[model samples]
Target: MITLKNITLRRGAKVILDGASATINPGEKVGLVGRNGAGKSTLFALLNGSIHEDGGDFSIPAQWRMAQVAQDMPETDESATDFVLAGDTALAAVNAEVAAAEASEDGERMAHAYMALQDVGAHDAPARAQALILGLGFQNPELDRPVNSFSGGWRMRLQLARALMAPSDLLLLDEPTNHLDLDALVWLEAWLQRYAGTLLVISHDREFLDAITNVTLHIESAQLKRYGGNYSRFEDMRAEQLALQQASYSKQQDKIAHLQKFIARFKAQASKAKQAQSRVKALERMEKIGPVLAEADFTFEFKEPANLPNPMLTLQGVSCGYPSAEASAAPTTIVRNVGKSVLAGQRIGILGANGQGKSTLVKTIAGDLKPIAGEIVQGKGLAIGYFAQQELDVLRPQDTPLEHMIRLARDTTQAGRLSGQSTREQDLRSYLGSFNFTGDQVKQAVGSMSGGEKARLVLALLVWQRPNLLLLDEPTNHLDLATREALSVALNEFEGALMLVSHDRALLRAVCDEFWLVTRGGVLPFDGDLDDYQRYLLEEAKRQREAIKASATGQAAASVPAAAATAPVVNSPLNASSTAKPVPRENNRTRQMRKELEQCEARMAALSQEKQGIEARLNANPALDEIQRLSTRMAALQTELDGVEARWLELGNALEAAT
Candidate 1:
């Protein structure tokens, strides 16, 4: 078991953990919850022995091993698998010992070394590596490619996979889901479920925690409260505790006020002089409970902008794609003959294979990239707030939190509302409080803040914008469980239209009212519910499998090699087809299926055009999310489409034989 006993952590003059105590039993899974700067990360660092607390002790059994998932990757030339394997230092050492013994002429040492090797699975390293690969969602052959070739996010995944594979009794995962996509997230969830060791996961993903954990440890009022059960259960208990604390606090204040009044009135009366003196003494000695805070209870209330008359944005015959004339004899494109309009109150979600152009579609709507073959018309008085997935790059490390806010403020004269009138100090303090930065925290430099804090700052600034149309690209990344839940509440209550590109299935289902499946055929509108969409995806897969099997294997060359699968789909010719269905009035399963089928037909011509357009834009601007989402989604769609074509070929063969 791993335990923290009466631990107190202080940075300079500020106290983060005051006499906090907690324990994790063998095989127990606990999720740590707190606000942005609530010392969650610090506590993990302390547990890892990376940082020492000012006062108190962390107690863990000597027999147990510990491992931490690093948030940042090393600037090394290691392959993804190699980087992950580095986490297994003990196993590597054991392997090296075995190698040395094999080289030795002594027979006794060889027997002992071989036994040690068996204990660490040296005899079956290939199988062990494959298991780790599947657990971490690195089944793609491309994962064998040099880690330097992949982006930072994928590298983070490699780090996590390695930490998980380490022969450790305790796992400390800090925001492990931030860099993972939806499919990878699902895989991770399942992997953690089967893991036998103890786990302490610090993340903002609600579904992830709820799915994998059984207990919650909350840091509040200079103490750690251990609650048994999952996140929802913990939340219920937390609310009850907060309510009880508030009631007790109010009662104490009322008693104090009553005592003071009694003392003032009777002190002058000789008959009750002794009673008054007793009352005054009682007031001084009484213990007080501070006001209860419902975990990060600051609310977001944005002033709604003027309503738009037409769709928030409209695209006409828009062909968007990136062209690589140098790589190919002809330029490659992802979207063609695509046209669509997004109106007010449309919670559209873009989905396609990794390279099918989801982020390209989002960027196109956000006005970052112009469509190559069509007009994208922005509605009048449209206030747009765009949240890029890699928005952390936009932050300035040198500035203080206040400086960042002051720069982002629309009217400097509106300063009175943000910072105290004419006093920069008061303004910064209050504004920081909205995002939960307070006391000396506002004075601290932004560079020192954790990744989670910076992410919250980004969200806080975006909320300050009060935009009418919110376009979010994975906005939920790097958030904690509590923050993600609060975000769900805020987005649900917001008045503006939301167009989100997220791999967070739970977040999308909770907030989105509609979904636009960004496919190789273009954007097709469908029932926004994740469950419904999943059913459609499964059905599509099943249909295509039947199609592929019925047709002779040599008939159609639709299957793109997985190695080349990440590239744009410019060379393929997708014939225009009729498959348009009206939007469903009620989100029933049958109605949803019919709507999806129709929308797919109506979207064929437009989708072709969108593919071409996205390809061209990708060629011009090589953004990672845009490229990956489109590529993955397009690959899934192509496999399905090939199955359909293969089936069509089989039917033709059958008809010819009969004729």
Candidate 2:
């Protein structure tokens, strides 16, 4: 159990929490929630011992072991499986003692070390680690790949897996589902439900919090309030409380008004002067009930498009994927022969397992990537507003929100979509203000802003574009619950075609009228809702695991010698002779393909960094000559990056083929 008694916390001059008190009983899964920048993360820091409370007392069980995902990017050559396995600190300690004992030739010490190792389930450690990795969306083959080989997002997943692998009495997870797809999110929900420990998670996904959390701890106005139910129930309870508070406030105001009226009427009369004095004293001694200062809800809507484009976009034998680096080389097709029409007012939710080409399909439709084959027919007056999965893909970190709006206005004017529209700076500021960007924030660099701010900026840009078709990929990733709710409302009201890919089930259910599932290198309409899709994902995952296990067993049996094949094999965890079988080795070509894939990814990352650097310098309002020179280099870098990314995709395709 954890206790916080009259805890007061501050960051610089701002008081985050003032005399806030809360008690979390042992094994209670609590969802800590609040508006963005309302000190949810700051509280997590206190719990993790990163910072001490400014005043009052806070305490946790002294013997409780805590596990949390590290915030830093891991850079290591250790294989993913080995990296995750190392998270079991107790088992590692036992193994270390065993090695030391064996080196010293101490029979008694070695026996003690072995006993400790057995107690920690050393023999099953690898299986447990692999299970965690797989559940987090790692492929069976990726388990043995070096940790450094994964991209930042995948590496973060590995970090999460490692955290889950660790033995602990208390676990803290902050935005764990941000990097995951729907399938992985579903898997994680199931896993957390089974975890036998005190769990605390901070997430914007309503469904996720509701599924795994039993208690809700809300931080608001320097107060920590606990509710004995999940997020939905907490919301209901809080709304009721607010209503009661407002009623009480109204009643108090009426009583005070009556008292003031009586005192005002009697003060001038001689007979009632003494009574008036007594009334004044009574009023002075009365506790003034503060009015309910309700937090403003974020609300915004997309302006009507300049024109409605029926059959906004149509695909004909479209193979959506990445082109090859070499001009003559074949492109790597992710989703092939996609034939679908995005008509006006269509709401399509894209569903798929990770790596099943949901993003590839969206990117292709958004025109970020060209179709490898076939043709896409765009309707007359078609205008697209694309929200990329990653904010950096759509935003310049060095640019300000005002600058982005200015450029968008310029582009819209040039395209003849806004002939008579005002393109003034004041107009742009007012428009940005509608999205909650105001004052100094409008001029702040995108890189210096929080993720939610960046996301809002992206949304603001999308609304300003007045596109007839919107392609949103994980739009709610960085948004808080309020903003996400606002977005859902806005999207529902939008009079245009929409194709959304997101892990937020609430948003999906609210915005989408139908679904398109990307799987097995193709796209098709899904016949059911999100619930059915989730069941399908779970079943598919289980089938894959079984197939992999069967394949491994077959391969192991085939690899054994002819004489040894006749021997009866007894499978028992307690049998010392039943050693774990080795996984089959990768062929030379497969290994070489993996090596090339890693190299290509590294090169692409470097090129992207350099491009960003040039863009940053360009946005600094450099002199004309320097600006021209940097712009030329920036164009060249973009071309080079495009080619590198193409090569990377080609290498990825080759690796998948080998697998």
Candidate 3:
């Protein structure tokens, strides 16, 4: 259990937490939520022991094993799998001991070291690491790739995978879904659900929080408050509390008003002088309740377009892809033979798995990348406002919000003279104010601003353009719940056509009326909504896994004939003619090996199930004698399971080769 008693935490001159107390019991999944810069991260730091409290006691179990996602971008050439495997420090240590014992030619020491390896499940650590990597959206081929080869977003996914790989009693995840797509996000939610540890997560995703968290920790006015349920429940509970408080405040104010009126009317009258004095004293002694202040609200609307052009854009047999550097080479096509049309006020959601060309399609439509082989027919006075997924890529780090807007105004004005567009500094400041940038924030460098602030700035710039069509790719990636709600409201009120690619289900459900799926190198209209798409994703994943297994089996079977000897030779499956006869049955040795493989697999499965049951019992903290017995049994089972699996693989290989 973790406890905080009147903890006061500070960073420099700013007081983040003052007289804030909260208790987080073991095995509780809590969502820490607040506005941007409301000290959620600071509180996490306090829990992690990166910084000490300035005032009262903050304590967590000293023996608790904690894990957190690393913030720095890894700059090593190590294989991705190896990087994740490093998270299991105990497994690594056991492996190192085994290696050292072997080098020293110490049989007894080597045996002990091997036992340690089995106890920690080191032999299967690679498989566990690979599962995490795959769940986080890394393809099989990318497993052996160097960590340095991945982009920033992919690197962050690697970090998340590493953190998940750790065997921890307490886990701290801050914005873990920031870089994940819908598929990965769903997988992560499932993973967290099964996590048998104390989890404290800081996230702006409401659905994710509701899925994983059983408790909500809210930070407001330098005070920590714990709510009994998830984010939705917290909101409901907070609303009720505020409503009741407001009512009480109103009653108190009415009583005070009557008291003051009575005192004013009777203070000079000798008959009622004592009564007036008593009323005054009562008013002074009353405990006043402060009025509830509503949370800061952000609201904005996209300006009406100058012309609502019908068929704002048309793509005729469009092949969207990236062009090759060599002038002579053909461009690589991603989504081929696409035919689509966008009209004013149409809200289209582009749906697909990661790396399936959703962003490529948007880029082609935005004119950032030209279509490989088709025509993009633009209507008369067709204008587009694009918001890329990487907000930092479009924003100048050194420029302030006012400066960015000023530059955008100047650029737009020079491109086409639009009426009512101004480049004045004061006008730009006013425009920024609508997006919640005010006063000195307007002059602060964009590089120093939080991700949510930068995203808002990007949206503000997009709105100022007043384009007839808007192309947004993952615009809500870094935005908090409030800002996301604001964006949804604004998009709903928007008059222009919209093409959005987002993993946010709530946003998609609220803003989009139609869905387009990009998959298997083609673009087509999906026949269903977001829920249907989610089901499709799950089915697709299962199909892919089965297909991979089938492919491996086929490849193994094709090699069988080459190893046959002293038997009638059968034509190889790869080289067989259309009229080739069926292959003869395998010999006795191959058949026996196949039977052994089946039996070995069954034994391994049973042992694995038993091992898991023991581990679950251990987590419940049984008696010392029971723990020892379970541990010993688990180690023995691990050893037997390893041998059985090895033998099974050997039998499979021999059977494949001897057919």
Best by TM-score: 2
lDDT per residue (tens digit) for residues 1-659 in model 2: 89999999998888889999999999999999988778999999999999899999999999999999998999999999999999999998999999999999999999999999999988667767877787777766577878886667888999999999999999999999988889999988988998999999999999999999999999999889999999999999999998988899899889889889999999999999999899899889988777778778899998888888788989999997554444554554557898889899999999987767788788888887789888999999998898887655558989999999999899989978867667999999999999999899999999898888989999998888788899998898889999999999999999988999999999999999999988767898899999999888778766765665665567667888987987766775555555767678999988888888888787877776555444333322235565556556655666777887888888888777777
- Over 1-659, each residue of candidate 1 has an lDDT whose tens digit, in order, gives 77778889976677889998888899999999877677888888887888897777788788888888766666777766666666777778887887788898678988888788778865444334444554443433433557665556656777777787688888899888877655456657766887888999987777788889999998776678899988878988888988999999999999989999999899999999999999988988999788875554655555555564467778898866543333322223456667888788777776654445676677767877667578888888777888887676678988877777777763635643333223355665686687778777766777888776787788877776667888898887776555666777888877778888776777788888777776654777765566666555545434433443444233323465756857766645542334655554544654544555555554553444444433432432346665655445444444455455555455555545544
CA lDDT of each prediction against the hidden true structure? 0.70, 0.85, 0.85
Model 1 bad stretches (over 4 Å): 107-119, 122-139, 254-287, 293-296, 314-320, 325-339, 352-356, 372-383, 395-467, 479-490, 503-506, 518-528, 531-659
By summed lDDT, which 10 consecutive residues of candidate 2 come out lowest? 613-622
If the candidates were sorted by their lDDT against the true structure, best first, what order would they fall in?
Answer: 2, 3, 1
What lDDT score goes with residue 360 in model 2? 77
Listed per candidate, the RMSD to the true structure in angstroms reads 13.0, 9.7, 13.4
Question: What's the residue-level lDDT of 327 in candidate 3?
Answer: 51
* TM-scores of all predicted structures: 0.70, 0.84, 0.81
Worst-scoring 10-residue span by lDDT in model 3: 612-621
Candidate 3: the clashing residue pairs are none
Identify the runs in model 3 with alpha carbons over 4 angstroms from their true place.
Answer: 103-108, 259-285, 539-659
lDDT by residue (1-659, candidate 3, tens digit) is 99999999999999999999999999999999988888999998998989999999999999999999999999989999999999998888888999999999999999999999999987557767777877776666567878986667788999999999988999999999998888788778878988999999999888889989999999998899999999999999999999999999999999999999999999999999999999999999999988998888999998889998899989999997655444554444557899989988899999877666788789889997798898999999888889987655668999899888888888878877566887888988998998999999999999999888999999898888888899998899989999999999999999889999888888899999999998767888998987788777767555544655565557666767764723654687755668868888877877778788889988987876565444433322345565556556655666787799899888888777776
Superpose all Cα atoms of candidate 1 onto the true structure and report the RMSD in Å to 1 decimal.
13.0
